[model samples]
Structure formats: C-alpha cells, structure tokens
Target: MKVKRPGLVTVIVDLNFLNVFLLIVSFFPKSKFIEQFGFYFNPTPSFFGGYN
Candidate 1:
C-alpha cells in the first residue's frame, strides 16, 4: 500500500499555526530562546525575513 500525502489545506494550516506561534514568541522578552532553537528549522527565511 502507498502512504497518503498531506493535502494543500493541511500544509497551509500547519504553516499558519507556525506563523502564529512565532508571532507570539516574538512579543515575549525571551524570544531569543525561540530564535536559538528556530535555527534548526531554518526559520530565518520566513519568520525573521518578514519581521526584519
């Protein structure tokens, strides 16, 4: 049997969730913590690119 792939809606929803999460973290004084770990996911192109 072939494995099913995620739909476009699923991919979009996941990205939106991540955006909201990062936005919330950016408001906190300890956002540096998020940045430190976010590097592992290469968030710079999406998150930091928009903010900066």
Candidate 2:
C-alpha cells in the first residue's frame, strides 16, 4: 500500500486561503453579512470561539 502526500504548492495555497479567510472573519466579526452567512458556510464552532 502506498500513500501520496499533497504537493507543496497545494499546501501553501490552502494555507494562504485559510489566512485570507481568517482575516476576513476577523475584520467583519460583527457585520450583519458575516452573522448571516459565516455560520451557515463554515459551521465550525471552534473557528469562531475565539472571536466571540
């Protein structure tokens, strides 16, 4: 059996996306748009725990 790891570029891209998302979430913590869509989209309690 063999397992293949993700490519370096893929990992970097994913991290970049995560950073951007966190930035947006942090900036708009109390915005109406975030309140309405963030939970619906992310639905990760821990991800939002720090902000609240």
Candidate 3:
C-alpha cells in the first residue's frame, strides 16, 4: 500500500458562484436582497442579459 501527498498548490472549480456569492453576501446584514420592492417580479429578458 502507498499514499500520495498533496502538493502546496491546489485548484478549486464549481458551478455555484452566484449561489455561493449570494450566501456569503447574505452574511452581511447591509446587503440588499433585491432592487426596489416589485421590480424583480416581472423580470424582463433584457435585464437578465443587461450585464453585457
């Protein structure tokens, strides 16, 4: 039997950045959950792609 030791370097990959980020952001009470009261209700497609 044998074992391999981990190197000093490491790599991390995930598909939940937004979810994780939001969770971390939630830790701070100052974070705003959403913009306005009902603006997020009827989300427009343009808003989703507005980042670009």
**Compared to the true structure, candidate 3 yields what TM-score?**
0.29
Please give, for residues 1-52, the per-residue lDDT of candidate 1 as tens digits: 9977679878999999999987777666445576677533333445546733
Clashing pairs in 3: none
lDDT of 2 by residue, 1-52 (tens): 8977679978999999999997878765556777676443443456656542
Estimated TM-score for each candidate = 0.48, 0.43, 0.29
**Native-to-model Cα distance after best TM-score fit, residue 16 in candidate 1, in Å:** 0.4
Q: After superposition, how far is residue 5 of candidate 2 from its true place, in Å?
A: 12
Model 2 CA lDDT for position 28: 59
Model 2: colliding residue pairs: none
| Model 2 misplacement above 4 A | 1-6, 31-52
Flag regions of model 3 displaced more than 4 Å.
1-15, 31-52
Give candidate 3's whole-model lDDT. 0.47
> Cα lDDT of all candidates, in order?
0.68, 0.71, 0.47
Error of 1 at 44 (Å): 16
